[model samples]
Target: EYPDATATDPTIVPFGPQEGESLSNCSTKFLERIRDWCVNKDALPQTVDVIKLLLVERKKAECRVPTHPPKDESTGDVPRAIVEAQQDEIQFPDEESK
Candidate 1:
């Protein structure tokens, strides 16, 4: 028999912008809050983890594209993974700003 489980609800907090405000710092704070709630057994743990993961993934996607393209204007077929991996090893300076 299912008993009434309406006694539980989570308190939501909002983020503020100011000095030292950055995505990394904000994400860490958000995860800590989620951990506090989960450790106290106030909310679902998996949901919080998924949200954290999504924020991290979105940041990665946004950073993957170059803010400035190479000067050659050649859109090569190489996958981003290979380019990123070789970037440091090959030491090719960015041609975009030239």
Candidate 2:
């Protein structure tokens, strides 16, 4: 007799390390980049949260999954001020190059 599976079925897909890249090294590099960018931008608490969320989305993209299915890109847990700051930084990145 086969048991009925629930809606939240945990089908595990084992992911091995990418060619020449261990998971630990990849994670370390990812976090270091995030930290450097955040520090350069003088990130607030909300900005940190947004950065983390973005990283998660990027990971999902790498895994060939949908990015943030429930949450829309424009709307997240981050504050409006932080979101605005991030937008401004994107638009005026040259200012930081000087």
Per residue, candidate 2 scores C-alpha lDDT tens digits across 17-83 of: 2332334444555566667767888876767686677567556635753223333357755433333
TM-score for candidate 2, please give it: 0.33
Candidate 1: C-alpha RMSD to true structure equals 13.8
Reference-based TM-score of each model = 0.33, 0.33
The window of 10 residues in a row where model 1 has the poorest summed lDDT is: 14-23
Off by over 4 Å in 1: 1-10, 15-20, 42-98
Native RMSD of candidate 2 (Å):
17.6
Q: Show model 2 residue runs off by greater than 4 Å.
A: 1-18, 54-98
Q: What is the lDDT of residue 32 in candidate 1?
A: 78
| Error at 81, model 1, angstroms | 32
In model 2, what lDDT does residue 34 have?
65
lDDT of 1: 0.49
Task: List model 1 lDDT by residue over 1-98, tens digit each.
Answer: 86434335345543421122333444566677667867787668586675777576646744653544333336554444334433423233355733
